[model samples]
Target: MKKLTKFKRIVTRIIVLTLVLSCAGGVMPSTFTPNAAELYSDKEKYISYNEETEMYEYSFYDAYVYDIDATPGQIMLDIIPSTGSNYYNYYYHKKILITWHSYNGENAAQYDYENQKLAESIQPESRINIKFAAKNKYDDLSYKDGYLGWESHKDFYVSQIISIRNSDEHIYGDINDDGIIDSFDVVTYQKYITDNLQYKLDETQFLNADIDLDTEITNEDCRQVIDFTLGSSKGFNGATNIGSIRIDNTVSQAMSLGVKNDIDFATAEIKFGVDVLKKCYDPEKNNTENILISPLSISSALAMTANGADGDTYEEMEKTLGNGLTLEQINEYMAYFISHLPDKDKEKVYLADSVWFKNDPTLKIYYEFLEKNRKFYNAEIYKSQFDETIIKDVNNWVNKNTKGKIPRLIDSFNIRSNTAMMLLNTLYFESEWQEPYIDTIDGTFTDLNGQKHLIKEMHSEEYQYFDLGNADAFKKPYLNGDYSFVGILPHEDVTFNEYVANLDGKELADGLREYADPETIRLCVMIPKFKYNYQKSLKDILTKIGMEKAFDPDNADFSNINDLSVEGALPLYIDDVLHKTKIEVTEKGTKASAATAVIMGMGAAPPEEKKTIVINLDRPFIYMIVDKNNVPLFIGAATQLSEN
Candidate 1:
């Protein structure tokens, strides 16, 4: 009897030990938990290699980013991987860093967003490699374009930096990433203290030096402007002219076909610059010997780089749309659209890599869709000269794209001579806020004159909110992927302009996502749905809103262009800028469309928007178009919106 009892006790002990070793190991000792550093000691253990993008992806939260301000147009991320997302021994990847490039309104590269001149000139590097599958392979709301049957596995990441080139022989100068011209960048400026530096800056370095992002080289007067760099942040900070600008102006120009007969201008052309990029700086790298750079990449810091612009991967765009596209379609279209083109031509064309057509080969059909709906758009149809009926088809597409806001586009398109080779000029958009705002109450708010008015305000809840502590207000951004509507409400005491002027020193910060971050505010929110059309000379507004250097003709240098002769170096200029937009909402979603036509010298136009509330737009409120860096491209306040 004693021996049998002892045997039972031994069996129970064995079973307990087995349970402790299992995955759901219940109640392990506290000492077993690893410290942050200990767990991170072998960073590679946390991540896995993405066969598709050829990049090592880190699965851990807040992975290592060696320098947010690396080369001129890049941010070096020191990714140390760990088990995350799918780590039951297998690795699960999450987010990654990206770059975006800024647009050269007139000259390609000359100064920073604050209009500060670049101390030196460096050429931009080409080859923006971004993959969407890496960002949203597991999410449900991604979108794709074209006939490639929307890619199902295009997890995309952002590439948000832009780098351009310099035409002159000046050295590149930019030492810090504060976006300010400060003394810390003395070495950068010192290199260019004289134009005759022995070693000619590689095309890559010169590309990153062009801030203001115009292609002009610097002279002592512009480059060495005595006080310019005193405290300026010279690196790009990821801001472009509303990546939607080209699209906005395209439809506007076509609809308001009223020509500017009063001001006789010599040239009006907008160039497409996908392949025309040069290397951006990696301040953190600072390897003058073999300066490493990736050009045509989205600018991680340049204020002019847009999310939709180059630099970022089409994969990222697809991932944002959630589930409309597939990976094969995206790859096929990218291969086909960019199939045969010169470096210059490639630099001038860009397409949504993720969006695939039903019949992959008939891409021009998009233009035809617009052409058929011309009257509503009031746009002209430009016929294509490429495939058999590209001209007529493109014209119809212009109309369809605009959804009646623009009419008569592509009226004189030549697929080969006009549409195919020309810079794109058209736009189409339709999106509603995920969380709609309805004006259910008449709330009192103050305007500029210290006058209080009983205004009907729109109210709703958002996935996130940004605290405008500087403006004494709260900002709620409603996003439908790329298309979005942001409504800001200032504290009743402050005026719109007063709020804006004070915002100069403050950072323009916003954080929106499915999950809240530390900086996010979980506030009960209210948003007003107010629609108003704004008309301004695109060029004039660019200058008024802080990007003054680009319009400086003599200081502009854009010789990287194949057509633009480099007799020595050529000064640059912008000929025309146009914009048009429309917004509508219904039970389904918001339908917003816009176009921007920027004619660089005498080039082509490119075109590429949200939704509603129950509130009437009667009282005044502030509105602005700003870059990611907080540089306001355009700012205004609407006093009233006639319901008529």
Candidate 2:
């Protein structure tokens, strides 16, 4: 069994070497033929006499090629016995001679049976051919003479054409050469740096392990690998754009849930966003009012709060945010999504979460809830006195997380004495257009109330066009193509609010999935440069969306958040859900930020042939900043335009 296994290993090694050589450039054909005399009767044979050649021929055994490294320019070759005997028994009175020659037949180096291995210096881009031979000490003479001197045998040659190049030219952090920089590479690199690697890394892998290109393996390289694995904004030398390949239990669970649903989690996310939009936008009362909301922000904040709820409150929050998925599933999905989000220095989508509870001794916050949030959401937890100072701290955290887009989230009046805790989620997105609009033309935007306002419209030609039946839409990609700005202009017959009201999540999701081929269809997009800030208290909105139990102080079940066993402890209910957003759409790109605070009280398609589609947003239209997965990060409407 052992011999069979060894044979299989040798065969695998030869196949792998053949493949490597083939990939490098080419491989020389095998010219080895077994001698019949040696194979038939090799009891104590030293050499074989060839009848055709009329001379003594050397008996050769099989040789296996292990690996090749370019930096040191060495090839690992293992010569084993053909009869599966020990080396000592097979070559007892014999000495093996290995020689390497350059491509031009120039002798490079020679070795004489030193541990059956050889290492020689071969320059890069040079081809080396190796030859192996064995000579045995003569105890008897042949028919030629009675001499007892050692005689040279016929050489056994296995030629390989190796063209090695500098290792620094390969992927920087892809140490395993799996075509991705992932956690496995991080582990392998860490093992290499620590000198605990079981197998030696080749030249290419060694260079890849040096992530910073400092020519030395250090902890910093391991740190960069870890950072890249964890999805850092500052990537590991340009190699960080390969996307994350880490798959933990949370990611697995999320993926399983998505697969079970027969649709992506992004569809459910978009459904929740569209639901919020429909509830927030009042077509009759606020027809001319601009509305903006980040469903991601709202959902994240509510998800954190859901971790602290028990029964009806948890169910309502889960339904509103997760679209019928459980809290655990939602948490896993959101966690995986946020961690794997593609982020660049210039074009970034930063999402941050925090939970602050009043530091009063009477109100004891649940440790399990906070730990779950920290583990899944990476949320920052704080215990504060809930005073004017705590208000500033919360606002400061919001301001920093939003990249100053939202300077203040909560004032003194917003943080009441009944507020026991606050769960906040902030999203900051800044990205330049994939194709910047270089021209700006004076245009007029007619509001829903038929009020015309002079505006400066940014004009650009987009390729991705979407026909929403009642709405003409166009998608303009941001830099890196990880996110895009989708503009949906309702048809003249249908009002903006009417279009939004009639639009369902499935329709929008399916419509976004279908778009005309850019090569065939061209979109002439003219969008008004708009800047706006929107703030609203979502207590009534959420209640209208079937979250009434969460706001009901008497009926809300938030026992998981605080210790209700304490005497005279008022039940914690969601006092209000505050949402604030700011957006600036210019010729360069869009810079949008949003903050959602769940104030906790003692409560909680292919187009056919060259067609041009013109989508002019000369009136109220819906705009959304969506991720690569078509999940809406920020969805809003531009009903009215102003200079500010």
Candidate 3:
């Protein structure tokens, strides 16, 4: 009897030991009670890749426990992988690092709402299960291992099979992840920085919250968010400020008729540029002692304004602006043009457009017009009281957009009482020459009036695009090959004004098409270093070019600008077409800024030898800053040189 009793005791002891071993192996019985203290580990584990399965494996060292009676809550996690891991390079993958927070029976609605907001915020990386479960609920709402369907359930294992890689794509100020950076994002970012955010974020959200990408959250990120949201600055991302604005400027996806081809559009731009230069060069019209005008800025501003015109006004404006292409075609061309403009290290080009209207209750703006401008032009629309402060506001915007090149655009009284709206475009460019000038040497430059001015000449001998057909033209590219400065030195016997008057768009286009090939052509170039600023009211220029009806208040039909049926609505016509431009050319390269405002009032190095072409700009000559597409950015005649 004693031996049998001892054997029974040993069997019981073995059964108890088996249960303990099973618990130690990560298999807890359903009835086992969990200790909250032992559920969490102090050290976090990173995800590791398994070569055998070719999958990323994440092993939970400890189970995070949320008691049945505990309040529903969230915990922001940072599960950064080890350094030099292959996963860090997967930037394009849509990924989210998700850990279940909690869902209580009493607050199921709250759980659904908060989780829904979180799911919406995950973008460019994660996607919510759009598939429906047995009921109307989304498959992802409920707990499911490996497959996050939106149905609700009661299991507390934090179940979901997420195959998402870590999200590495983060817009500079896109903290909320709604595909845009705006005031709401600024608020959320500020809260996160200040430690006042109500709920915690997941690992991906934390990654994106690092706005400056310094790997640490700070106050500067919040300030950057505010600056971008308020339009006080271009954007937080250093890649391209224009792209950041594009994120917010998302209107309709309908593609407009773009230019028929790059060459055709470039030819048209060349023609229009020549026309503008001719009109601006007329002795009776131009008042600037030294001239520099941005054909791109003027053309873009006019194109945007033409969208709001109709009848004779529209027809004349369209004829003047569009070189035979329809408005749809022009819209397509401008959209393509702006998108292709280069903005990067050492060579930066920023072009911004905006429309500001008086906050008059009687006016109603057309949605289609606004949408088209927003989508194509990426123009900012603002409605403000046309008070004395409007001038400061507009100038502030100009200063910010141009990086303070043209600080004060207008005085306090630039906006007349009859002015109903104002449209503006600002262009900023800075680039380093691929082959910088050797050095500044004192030289003599003869002005158009036969006046000889002592100037510093920049000399360099290198392989450049050179042709002596219509005129002696040599192209000097900037740091990148995206843009070039083409200087045309007319024949020694020909006068600057005479050559310009005779040079038409086709001739210039033909010469450029032939010479500006990617192949290197040997050339010796010598040009004077010049700095000049030009400002003018283009009213006469536009009228001279066949857009006269747009300036005439009585004859103009700008009925499309705003709803004409609204009470107190007055006829809207362009008040003034003002243009301000500044450029500096030195041994390094060029830094230029131009602002065009339309106010409406109720109303290098080397290879020489094979075929050497010499270009010496000792006399007056014409020059242009052009892009890869031969689209002229700035066109001017260096008739005079001012001593810096």
Candidate 4:
């Protein structure tokens, strides 16, 4: 008996070793054996591998054990069939048995010894034994004290158990689970369909190779897959296999309130604004009429609009506004420029932006576009019902932001039924002059048409940044030194149109910064107390630039903006851009506000050498409100004045 016990222990160790090594080598693992006596039958069973059938045949045994009525403990027999072996690593299918037994013996050591012996005989069937203790007297076993002392009670029984195994299946479309379906999959699928090579596939592979998702793979599916490989079509359907790009939205920060110290990278945007401003100048408009535009405001709203554009639509918009800078560069510079626009004490300049879209279920706008606008432009987003109420909502937003200066932006019924979204920017500025002047005295102001009108001009003599040459210019600072008002009086030799025609944004901004150095001498400054409003549709002007494709509904591509898969979806394109501005220059200060709406379907140096300069605005002259970075907040030609 002692020798048999030692042999059982050695055999159990060998089975454990085999299981551990087999699991690591992609082979069937061995099972454990229990040691309790009378738990398993000693009748020997044998299993042999059939090479011809690639299956394991096992010796059958009596399906039933004794149906002995026990006080508590009960034992039974069970067998199950196996069926999984795809191409990848897996376990072989076979029958397995589990036994539940309890010993009611005073010698616990003897119980273990007898079970170990019973375990050795059942090795051929791959049996595993697990022994556990009952938590309470009413649990698995019941105890009773024998005359010899305390003894374990056998009250355990086997219950119904389901054997489930890991699934062996291939990934759909990506047959090899490589995350992409390329030429390799196409070739394999073609070979399988042609039957040139005997290829076997499970249900998963069948679903994967069915390109059209029609439950079967036909020759047309093969041709479509080939086209997808060649990039002629996106995928089996109208979708692309690649996932959409994602934008991170976890970042948060307080908006800055001062101008950017450096304006080096801002040249591209500033230059573009200047170029657009020059192009907006019309030679045929009334000579007495004034033209005011906030290029920065317009560009900002459009920059936000560009977030949803893709392909040619994006490229043209970028090229029109970049002036050589990439989209990333433009976004960085504009975000910095707008967020840090010198809104210090007594300088009430507000640059606000908003985006409004219809809350339609069919239009699935990309979160990335929305996130980009929010992060870069501090854009306020709203989803409305594209009804008549949207007009009031938009106008209310504009009016509230502009402090009522802009009463209404969207007309009573200008919003078309198909309008998907609208992007808006508003700039409000009200600053007291650094050197307050009395009311303008009655003076003679000549218009560009050579017509002279009696005007009330404000007068002051203070140390100012002044330059005199081909064109006389001066910079008068407002409340804070962070902002200044620039006046450019075209020389009598050239018209205001001719002068601006030769100017570009970089040179204009550079000149504003370079020529604004304070002079030792104080020069007499006289400027008219004027108030005027300019409003116009910028569709033709924007088209004149290289952005004509954005207005072409047939050619524009705003796939990145909203989902194009909806039935009856109209192409997103820009209908028009409406801009309105009002400026009031008085003895106390200058109050100006401008709103620019980039309505989309879905869319310098100079310097120097001047000490004391004298300039009289007795004729037509150009002016601009510039920030510390020389950004033109408002650029206009003051041609007429009110007598009151």
For every model shown, the clashing-pair count is: 202, 9, 18, 10
Candidate 3 — number of clashing residue pairs?
18
Poorly placed runs, candidate 4 (over 4 Å): 1-261, 341-345, 462-469, 516-522, 602-612
lDDT of each: 0.30, 0.66, 0.64, 0.60
Q: Which pairs clash (backbone N, Cα, C closer than 3 Å) in model 4?
A: 35-114, 35-115, 35-116, 36-115, 73-155, 258-340, 440-457, 440-458, 507-604, 573-601
Indicate the residue-level lDDT of 619 in model 2: 89
Q: Model 1 segments beyond 4 Å from truth?
A: 1-398, 408-427, 435-457, 472-485, 504-506, 510-522, 543-556, 562-572, 585-589, 602-619, 623-637, 642-644
TM-score rank, highest first?
3, 2, 4, 1
List model 3 lDDT by residue over 286-400, tens digit each.
2226677887898888888888888888888777777787777777888877776677756999999988877778778777777777767888877777787677677778877
Worst 10 residues of 2 by lDDT: 239-248
TM-score of each: 0.31, 0.58, 0.59, 0.57
Q: Model 1, poorest ten-residue lDDT window?
A: 263-272
TM-score of 4: 0.57
Q: What is the C-alpha RMSD of each candidate to the true structure, in Å?
A: 29.6, 23.8, 22.0, 33.6
Deviation of model 2 at 198, angstroms? 79
Better of 1 and 4 by lDDT: 4
- Residue pairs with colliding backbones in model 2 are 514-605, 515-605, 571-602, 572-602, 572-603, 573-602, 573-603, 573-604, 574-604
Worst 10 residues of 3 by lDDT: 127-136
The number of the candidate with the highest lDDT is 2
